[model samples]
Target: MDILVCVKRVPDTSTNEIEVNDAGTDIERDDLVYSINEWDNYAVEEALQIVDRVGGSVTVAAVGDDESDEVLRRAMAMGVENAMLLSGDAFAGLDGRGVATVLQAAAKTKGIDLILTGAQADDGCAQVGGMLAAMLDQPFASLVNMIEVESDKTLKIGREVEGGEQEISRIELPCVLSIQTGINEPRYVGVRGIRKVASVEIPTMDAAALGLTAEALAPQVERLDYFTPEVGAGAEMLEGSTEEMVAKLIEMLQAKGGMK
Candidate 1:
């Protein structure tokens, strides 16, 4: 199967009370905890299960600084065969397109047959998987919730569509898929598993090694600023006891034509 799963390390939203930085360009990161992106966990687990059945290797890759090694190692602790860190000065401040370009290069070198990524990262930009596929000139599918390998070269995939429906299609090998969560329950990585791979080395690839120039890695979109949206003034609070509040809520809904 020779699957490559792309993962990311993001702020642990559950633990961190995210606040805007003084500069308003990004979140306040100091003293914040980081972990694998929740959606990426599902993607990695799906890749592992696929390899377990089809007999091949599952490699997890991340685009970040050395600190990202933690997430990669965690993926290793979850039974991934190999991990690679795509990192370098040039990779810094890259946007979604640049990231896809880096992964496209890595995919070529690894002789990968299938590439999997989370439907979206913490950034909520669900563009990488499709962009990587386009850059590689391979078939692509997003929001993939089910995958059934029909043969060495073909796969039957199920995707979620509008109206809460599932769309099933056959996609050939050498393709990329953005895996949706709930596809599988990701396995837990305990302290023992983390310690087991603690000493294992993970390879790192830089822009130069990937034949990428600084200009090539440059981000097209620039963020001018980051500010919290102004709170809008709107509704009235319902008062009185529970029954009265319920009645008031129904009255408002009916007044707004929200109820029959």
Candidate 2:
């Protein structure tokens, strides 16, 4: 059950505001702290958990520049067998599809049997898993919560859907699965563990190494414009007793066509 897990470094915005950069096409990342995207951590951990059960290795990969190695080291520290950096200056400003393009090239060299990724990046464009599946011409399932790799080279998986229901299926291996969180609790890496692997080098492959050219890797989608929204007035507070509030609410609703 050799696994390849793809992770991304996303801004840790839980404690910080995401400010649009002066260029407006993206955020100001220079001063922001980055961490493995929350869902992707689950993907990494899920891969580790699977291989731990069936006896195999988990290779982690990421698409980014040199600064991207932080998350890869963290994944290795969590006990991944190896890490690869799919990087190039040409990869800058690429969209999710472009990222998938590079990742597919790198993945081909790794001899992966199972591929895992978060259902969606925390930064929120959920396009990579499906796109990569298409690029590799492999079967894909998204939002999977449970997995059972069978002896016959197929997997029985349970996918999460709305209203707490689950969809189950049996799919062949060499498939792509976009993992959903709560599938498993990600492990915690102590500072010592991180530091122990801190100096370990992760091999990187640039676009050329992956047989990619600048033209083949350009973003298919273009960002036309970006703007910071003007601050608006605060909401009106309805005051008084419950009855008064209900009456006021009814009046407003009637005025707004929400009620007759």
Candidate 3:
């Protein structure tokens, strides 16, 4: 069984310097720190765990420029067998559909049996995994919280729904799964694993190598601009005795149409 885990390198959200450019609809690259998307890391860990249990190879792949190599190397350091980086100018400024096209091309080349990805990426729209499944003409299950390999060809997955309910599903091989965060505790890179895969070469593939065309890679959506939201002033605190506070709450609610 071969599993392909899709990972993404995103700007660390903790850095206040990271900002999106309004002109090009791209992330402001200056003074930026890159790390794997937290959710996608979980997906990689999950894929590794499954492959470890089932006795197979796990390959981590990413769609980005040269910066994405670090993200793939990180996954390899965590026990993935190999890594692939999909690149090219054609892949730039791609939305969900374009990304899916690239991933589908890579997966097809690898003859992957199962594809795992985060439910959404942090930097861009979160629709790539499902769109990739659609482009590949394969089944997909999103928001997966738990996954069990029932056999070499079947997988049982659990998804979370509203009201704390869960929807369980069983899917055959060659399907896509957009996993939820916290599905498993992602493992830290040990000294040995890091040393072993840190120097491992990551292969690069372009649109031509992946059998993709610029027209076929057109984005389904377009971004106009981006800007930080203006910070609003703090709300006034209404402090008083219990009875007085209740009256003030009623008045405030009425003023805001809560009682209308």
TM-score versus the correct structure, for each prediction: 0.94, 0.92, 0.90
Better of 1 and 2 by lDDT: 1
Give the local distance difference test score of model 3: 0.87
In candidate 2, which residue ranges exceed 4 Å CA deviation?
229-233, 257-260
Across residues 15-126, which tens digit of lDDT does each residue of candidate 3 receive?
6476667574666778788899988999999998888788789999899999898888889888888899999999988887888889989998877889999988875466
Could you tell me how far off, in angstroms, the CA of residue 13 lies in candidate 1 after the best superposition? 0.8
Model 1: per-residue lDDT, tens digit, 1-260?
A: 89999999999999999888999899889999999999899999999999889899999999999999999999999999899999999998989999999999888888899999999998798999999999999999999999999999999999999999999999999899999999999998999999999999899999989998988888998878878898899879889999999999998899999998
Best by TM-score: 1
Q: In model 2, where is the ten-residue run with the lowest total lDDT?
A: 25-34
- Residue pairs with colliding backbones in model 3 are none
- Can you write out model 2's per-residue Cα lDDT over 161-223, one digit (the tens) per residue? 999999999998899999998999999998988999999989999988999988878888887
Model 2 Cα shift for residue 3 (angstroms): 0.5
Candidate achieving the largest lDDT: 1
- In model 1, pairs of residues that clash are none
Go through the candidates in order and give each one's C-alpha lDDT: 0.94, 0.89, 0.87
